[model samples]
Target: MARSLDLACRCAQLADELKAKDIIVLDLTRVTPEFDYFIIATGNSRRQLHAIAEEADTLMEKSGSARIGIEGYDSNAWILQDYGDVVLHAFDPASREMYDLERLWADATRVDWQAYLAEHA
Candidate 1:
């Protein structure tokens, strides 16, 4: 389940474009067989949450990636977008606090977004 560098770079770009706070890309290849990476980020409000999710979708689409599904946007508390190799979770602070993916997927290795983006440059 090793993810390609291109996938990681795309994920980071999406996170950056959305102005996601404390963005972290998690490598789930070794732990979860379902997806390769988890792009998790936080938004301050419902508006921000929706914006971030939509921007990610747009980026994925432009990159020739088909979205499999989307959820939790009704409340804007959390939004999940399935993009085959990558799964994006954009959430409001409260929802993010409630369903902390970092803590939930503790087994998955944490990726330093800054370092990752720098290396890719």
Candidate 2:
């Protein structure tokens, strides 16, 4: 659980570095068995989304986190990167509002991403 949380927070920090908006880390361990956490962020454009997704994949892989699957990168509406325990969602503003993942996972606890980053820094 701690490892997954650390990975999720790392993903969130990466998103922040790329200037992704409204970055969030949702703890899904207690709420769901499919994944340990969800790292969600909003990108302003398809180019930005692709860059964010690519960088995230590279960073995770460098950290020994193998990406299990990736989807929607070509479309760029919403890119999903599956890193086993940590799934990342990079969405365009319109798609983010339409899908509303936060609302869907409202039961999950939101990790204090900034605080986590600060503590680790």
Candidate 3:
């Protein structure tokens, strides 16, 4: 599989496996010069947020993708895992509402879940 597709699949799988709510995939390749995609999701609580982050890390590692860094795991209000091409953001509802990364990056293309999966699959 293509690297980008594989990354997207892995991300979708992680989100589903962890029961991430309101999962959104942002195509940041054009919007941001840094990463290709941003996988953003909300967790019910801090514990779930931490679990999502850790699971994403494990999935990335198993897929042979190196984790660049992780931030905000201690509080779990927002946990960020950098995986070079893709960045995973796991947030509790409060933090999600507070930060509103989705609205912040609204100008970027919001990925169509079906299209994304089909293209990546």
Candidate 4:
């Protein structure tokens, strides 16, 4: 659980560094067994979304996390990077509003990403 939280927070930090908007870390451990957490964020454009996903992939690999799969890179609407325990969603504003993952997973707890990072640091 600690390792999963650390990786999710690190991914969120990377997205924030690249200026991804409304970055959030959702604790889905109790809600779903498929993934432990979800790091969701919005990008200003398709280019920015790609950039965020690319950086996230690199960072996850560097941290010894194996990427399970990636989807929607070409479409650039909603890109999903799956790292087994942690999954990242980089979406444009329109797609974000359209899917509304937050609302769909409303029962999941929102982890205080900054605090988690600081504590782990």
lDDT of 1 by residue, 1-121 (tens): 3334456556666767767787888888889778888888888888878887787778778777778998998985889989888888888888888998899999998877677667766
Predicted structure with the largest lDDT when compared to the true one: 4
Q: Model 3: per-residue lDDT, tens digit, 1-121?
A: 2575457556866787788888888887778788888888889988888888878878888888889988898885898889888889888889889989888988778776556667655
RMSD of 4: 0.8
The candidate with the higher TM-score, 2 or 3, is 2
Looking at model 2, the pairs that clash are none
Q: What is the alpha-carbon lDDT of model 3 when measured against the actual structure? A: 0.80
- Ten-residue stretch with the least lDDT total in model 3: 1-10
lDDT of each: 0.79, 0.92, 0.80, 0.93
The window of 10 residues in a row where model 4 has the poorest summed lDDT is 69-78
Ranking by TM-score: 4, 2, 1, 3
Q: Which pairs in model 3 have colliding backbones?
A: none
lDDT of 4 by residue, 4-121 (tens): 9999999999999999999999999999999999999999999999989989889989989979998898895889999999999999999999999999999899999999889878
Can you give the lDDT of residue 42 in candidate 2?
96
Off by over 4 Å in 1: 1-5
Cα misplacement distance, residue 100 of candidate 3 (Å): 0.8
Q: What are the root-mean-square deviations of the candidates from the true structure over C-alphas? A: 1.9, 0.9, 2.1, 0.8
TM-score of each: 0.87, 0.96, 0.87, 0.96
